[model samples]
Target: MIHDQTLDQATESSKAKKAVLYRMVMDKHTCPWGLKSKYLLERLGYEVEDHWLTTREQVDAFKARHGVTTTPQTFIGGKRIGGHSDLRTHFGLRLQDPKATSYRPVLAVFATGAGLALAASWAAFDTPFTLRAAEWFVSMTMMLLAMLKLQDVEQFSTMFLGYDLLAKRFVPYAYAYPVLEWTAGALMTAHALPWLSIPIGLAIGGIGGLSVFYAVYIQKRELKCACVGGSGAVPLGFVSLTENLFMVAMALWMLARMI
Candidate 1:
């Protein structure tokens, strides 16, 4: 199964807690996994025979002999334990799947926004269930989402360009989007400058909702959203659409207040 090691082979040897590690220690680069492996082995109370392949020639020869494409190979009682992942598996440790779809970040962000709104309401009116609190929940969420995208604008823009209709066409709008969202959200939260915030919110929200609708709901294509940021794994259909619609609603609400 894992690294071609059977259960018996993968199991730690009972005779002696000893491991042989072959890793790179070159001038320009040292294998991080190797260091991790060495540290893990040492922490586990294993006597590690740390062998450093310093030169390219030595590294190549070692790889050729072991039939391994990468270094940081571990052997326990003459059983090959493969790379860092394989080693982790051998020890029954948890490993994060980078490609796994997760909604935790989005959920956390929204939850935080709601909590902050309730707290602000408590501070302002001595109650957490005010109409103002409801408004703040939406506006604060928008600001939080904008803040996340602003963390790495370039990555957000790249992700935005992939699905956003306006970004796909104008391109520069993708880069300016986070700033616009943050500005609109901040003004809306403060209940200031409805004229500017309303227009910006309406424009971006309308375009964003349309884009999400076209790419996700209509086409039935599952896409990762750029709403919260590129690093997060928020789905594009319902949540993304909701984000846009919230802005539209907030903008309209601001307009109604002015009227």
Candidate 2:
């Protein structure tokens, strides 16, 4: 049933390639779905606005504006696109959008190297209470990086297509990093095992550096960036050199401290 008022507004609204304002409740699945739609819309040459309507007043205003009472509602070109099912209907089958970037280990490596360096510097050189604070910084950085990678709606479909294949196909085996870094940085400061800390930090840096380098090689040879989070700006050969060198530097510092 078409509401006269809704139709009138749809027609009357400025014909400037209308924006889609989506209203959804704050929930685990709904939020991700909503974000995915927003990203898809952006890629499809549309501007989409997402609002979490948790209050009655907000919902009322939204209904008045868009003329839809049911939710996971999407307003595109002043027309309503329903829930997840509706969104799927819109996309049909080209879910992956082949041009979309895949997750790359190089990006993760770069982010990790920067994070570890910051954590180590703060933990090693800062005041007495700074060790624990540095640990928090490193853990939070690693966790946040992982979260951002997970939230990349652009890669949503590709990730699903070859979960098994891609899961093991990471350029530099990047998944082992967070634990290595968090543990290395924590042990270096907490237990003050200078000898152990050198090796641990070096290992963390070494793995990251090698991964980024290989990613660069793959990128140049294949003309594809496998690093995640749209961070292909970092070239791998340089990234690898920088990372390995950084690890070696950290090892030297740790060794000096032990001596």
**Could you tell me which 10 consecutive residues in candidate 1 have the lowest summed lDDT?**
1-10
1-259: candidate 1 lDDT, tens digit per residue: 2243443343455225899999999999999999998986765567899999999999899889989899889998899999888888777666778777878888998999999999999999999999999999999999999999999999999999988998998999999999999999999999998889999999999999999999987888888999889887877888899999999999999899889
C-alpha RMSD of candidate 1: 5.5
Q: What lDDT does each candidate get?
A: 0.89, 0.50
Please report the candidate that would top lDDT against the real structure: 1
Candidate 1 — which pairs collide? none
TM-score of each: 0.69, 0.37
Off by over 4 Å in 2: 1-178, 218-245
lDDT of 2 by residue, 82-126 (tens): 765575465452343445543445556556645665666666677
Model 2 weakest 10-residue run by lDDT? 156-165
Q: Which stretches of candidate 1 lie above 4 Å from their native place? A: 1-84, 91-94
TM-score, prediction 2: 0.37
